[model samples]
Target: MTIKFRFHPEKAVEAAAILLKLHGKPMKYIGLLKMLYIADRLALKTMDQPITGDRYVSMDYGPVLRGVYDLIKGQPVDSALPLWSKYISPRDSNYVDLLQYPGNEELCEEEEMILKQVYETFGHLDPFLVEELCEEEEMILKQVYETFGHLDPFLVAEWTHDLPEWKDPHGSAIPILVEDVLRSMGKTEEEIEDISQEAQREAYLDGALPKIFG
Candidate 1:
């Protein structure tokens, strides 16, 4: 059986606030969502848990934290609504502003470092451009899952090395996946499923089940 993950609205709001403060200006909703997703992904890769523990869904732009996305749009999410309304700007605006300072209690030192690193890496780029890049990354990630059926970051990185999209001009080790390469090579569905299931089983044994399942 599949298990659904829980969302922490307070943490989501706090995270958004932190990102806004770090940015030192208003951020577009799309951009803020991408930053939050990257931070959560990093946390999941390193700490065995995500910052908000929100459900991730693939969208046209990229992967999004479903609950947080709703909150950003000022939707009435029961747990996060009050706090979100209190500190976050209205959904009518394309730009999100931090109405209050976020306390650091919800985020740990490691999580902060990951968020900081993400900001330093992508903060200067246009949000729309970042979204476009993320769309490509998301497609690659889906192929990786379909081909490998696992969430092991190291293995995924190694597998992505052979793909044409896997470029490193700056020598910075960005995360990538290999399923697209497999697809290009025309691997059969049966073969892909068999290999993906085996890899997913290994991932589960490695304690990555909850992060993905949840």
Candidate 2:
């Protein structure tokens, strides 16, 4: 049986918020989505768990986190849980702006560091920007804007395509199982079994303990 981790929208929101804070302005939704996916993929490989626990899928762009994608598009979701719209603006011309600061209480130091490093590696590097006379204008234009008049989403997508776990889904999408990723990373079957069981246990705690304790 395929093992799946429960998606936590709160963590997803907090993760995206951290990236947005580092971005310091509106970002193309696609770019933000790619950054999140890369971070989660890295987390899974290193820590045996993804940060948001969102379902993964392979699409034309690359591997995507399904729940986070839905949240980015502002689709109707469980209202009881924290909505992505609470902290991120509705899509405006395919770009999303951070609406407010969703506190990072759910994120550990390592997760936050992963997010920051992903942004640095994929998003933009301002240190390479050419210095300008006007300080404010330089700050605004410090980051390189590729074809999209901002961070180039396509470039980020191209990089994500290189991940071994991502397969070309042609015109359709395909689910990417967590086991698939672990195996691609050369994890032994025994190690994968242990990780999957741990994931199931974590899911149970997240779902059952709240009701039992409350």
Candidate 3:
């Protein structure tokens, strides 16, 4: 019922609010879409769902987000489909178009500045690649990290002892399944990790796991 979407850095939250209020907000913002996915996979694993890391992937955000928004607006969450139960399966895209302009160019300079600052505050931005990530989905997981890091009073009080790596949104290790996604692509492990970390956030967020989308 309490759906914590993305890592809420003070600035990212403010900038995103501006982005949504600009004209109209999408059913879900892009970054939230990404985090929603990582959260889904983590939920599946924690519940001991009958699925392997290779199977339980994130759900499609566009339709899911729209559906949930309408459902939450009308009926209770329990009435809606168990999104996790259905979409929980293995996952692994062409996304060059999204990478042309990295980050949220939709934001104004002032807004952009704030979002970037928030990204840095997180220790790093979306560093994992869409294709090369392990089952961990580190990029999306970053949101959960940021949200708790920002909003959780416990985390705030224990900042020095709690390093970023010590946290995971789904309460498990990240599944950065590099070899599986790029196995056919023939990328080496090192190359894949580099790509996943350096890949632009926009394309990575918008793109789906290759196995599903392809």
Candidate 4:
């Protein structure tokens, strides 16, 4: 059986914003992507639902939220691209910068905590002397690359590659179904069945809402 969840773009952007804010500067887009994927995985394991509700795919870097990845690449995934772009800049030199604060209204307290914890584990930037860095203008980009290594994007990718749910796509993208993740998390057949049914119901409601209220 196929399982799908309606992607919530606001939550996705807010999650990214939260991470970028924690980093306090432009971050390697890859690092942001990895942290978002890890947060979703953790949420799935503990909360029984992914925080972003995004479609997942195993890519060369690791598992990624397909819609968010498209947004990062400046593809219009949906109306949410404007929302994402408003708070986050397009990819620049392999990095993305936060343009402004995007409030986490769609995220709950637990979700915020999870994102923060994920940042601490994988992307928290240490306090650095801005004035000292300003003096070394020529090394700014070099510093970013060096700092990013310490921020753990590559490390996170390697760790995620070790997950049972992650498959090496061999340079091609492979869909990572929610059922696949559930199974990897040791969810029972009955539980997966129930979750799939619930997802179907949610999708139906998502479709009917606009028609019903419009």
Leading candidate by TM-score: 4
Instruction: Name the weakest run of 10 consecutive residues (lDDT summed) in model 1.
Output: 128-137
**lDDT by residue for model 3 over 46-151, one digit each (tens)?**
3211011222122222211333222223333343323321221111111101111113322233223322222233322222112222232232233333442122
Residue 10, model 1: lDDT of 64
Which residue pairs of candidate 1 clash? none
What total of clashing residue pairs does each candidate reach? 0, 0, 22, 0
The lDDT per prediction is: 0.55, 0.70, 0.28, 0.72
Tell me the lDDT of candidate 3.
0.28
> What does candidate 2's lDDT look like per residue over 23-45, in tens digits?
87888788888877877776777
lDDT of 2: 0.70
Model 4 TM-score (2 dp)? 0.86
Cα deviation at 179, candidate 3, in Å, is 20
Better of 1 and 4 by lDDT: 4
Q: At residue 211, what lDDT does model 1 achieve? A: 75
Q: What ranges in model 2 sit over 4 Å off?
A: 80-82, 125-151
Best by lDDT: 4
lDDT of 1 by residue, 1-214 (tens): 2223346676667667666676676767776676676666555445434566566655544555678888888787776777887777876567778887756665665665666565555554443001111222222222222232222323323433444434553532333232432344455656545545654565465577677777
Q: Order the candidates by TM-score, highest first — what do you get? A: 4, 2, 1, 3
Which consecutive 10 residues in model 4 have the weakest lDDT in total? 127-136
Model 1 alpha-carbon miss at residue 65, Å: 0.6
lDDT-based ranking? 4, 2, 1, 3
